[model samples]
Target: MKCKDCQFCKYEGAGIAGGYKCKHPNIEESAKKYEQLKRKVINKDYPHIGYQMIKTSLRYCPYRIDREESL
Candidate 1:
């Protein structure tokens, strides 16, 4: 299922800057890596490659909990 349909997905921030983030405890490592890659892109450390890598790294969550089931 898509992350947007998962129970662990949480929306943070506000307005246009707001987005859904995975809150699954098991996603900590992946989240950290994502943050690091995000920083690199923001800091222009690996601008081109970072963006591509980030795109590839984003996949359907393995630990996703279906919202319907949880409810």
Candidate 2:
């Protein structure tokens, strides 16, 4: 997938193939948080709440896959 699809990536140009930067300062922290939130969804622990939280958290995750790619 292209870097533009990554949550941590910041696109500088006008298109998807443009230059970008990984905005996550702490990769480990970002990953940990992502995983924890993901588990909540998997375990069905307040799925509604977890889904909302995960939606926001995923946008800042360093390891998040491109939504386009996943489909």
Candidate 3:
């Protein structure tokens, strides 16, 4: 009875290397593939939708892009 697969690994392994440990080769490849995907911006073209809209979108997004709050 040996632990061949690391618990963190997505796949189950049956080899014994200190009781189920994650193999770096496969994990590294999988991680690299995951990182290859391009991140998509939620709003690419629109400058500012609205206060409520931006709030609905997310809190991190700046609420003042082209505003002149002097009045």
Give all candidates' CA lDDT scores: 0.42, 0.40, 0.27
Model 1 residue 38 CA deviation in Å: 18
Winner on TM-score between 1 and 3 is 1
Order of all candidates by lDDT, from best down to worst?
1, 2, 3
- What residue pairs are clashing in model 1? none
| Regions of candidate 3 where Cα sits further than 4 Å from its true position | 1-21, 38-71
Best by the lDDT measure: 1
Tens-place lDDT digits, model 3, residues 1-71: 11122233233334432222233334333333333433433342122223221213211212211121222
- TM per candidate: 0.38, 0.26, 0.22
Query: What does candidate 1's lDDT look like per residue over 1-71, in tens digits?
Result: 54545566566656555555556665655444545645532332211121111323233233422232256
**What TM-score would you give candidate 2 relative to the actual structure?**
0.26
* Tens digit per residue, CA lDDT, model 2, 1-71: 23434455454444543344456566446445656665632332111122112223333244443342366
**lDDT of candidate 1?**
0.42
Q: Name the better of 1 and 2 by lDDT.
A: 1
